[model samples]
Target: MLTRAQVDENDTVLITGASGGAESAAIQLAKARGARVLAVAGESKHESELDAGAQEVPIRGCPLQDQLGDNGVDVVIDLAGGPNWPELLNV
Candidate 1:
């Protein structure tokens, strides 16, 4: 999906709910493909998400929203599929 979305080197990719196995695998895959991946999850799961090859972004207080500004994201691998869904649209 990342490749289909044209996620290349230096492109930003966001994958919500990184605590799960599928999400973690997606994070690793995105990283291996050279995309800068942001794994969104709870603060407690940040370390595990990072270990899966993604930069951490807490769902509660997502700094990425401000960091990405109006440019938004190149691609999103949404595993959470909840309220955070709309929020991920901006980053």
Candidate 2:
């Protein structure tokens, strides 16, 4: 997924469902590639996500745009697809 997204050192990647196994792996990979990672998951999982190399773990329920302000990510890896999926596109 990272390859397809052309993630690179300059990119800021936003990853949803960041507490899951795949998402955790994604976070590490994105970080290893030198891209900054922002994870979105439950508050309970924030520490683990941060440990996995996410620079910031935003609160899951909060609007991604609000947390990120005008500095939107360069790549969005959306692993959680549901009602909020469309919101990711906007961000």
User: In lDDT terms, which candidate is top?
Assistant: 2
TM-score of each: 0.81, 0.95
Candidate 1 wrong stretches, greater than 4 Å: 61-64, 67-71
lDDT of each: 0.77, 0.91
Residue pairs with clashing backbones, model 1: none
Q: In model 2, where do residues sit more than 4 Å from their true spots?
A: none
Cα lDDT tens digits for candidate 2, 32-60: 99999999999999899999999999999
Clash count in backbone of candidate 2: 0
Q: Give lDDT tens digits, candidate 1, residues 9-79.
A: 87878887778899989988888889888777887887888788886465546566775566666788888
Cα lDDT over the full model 2? 0.91
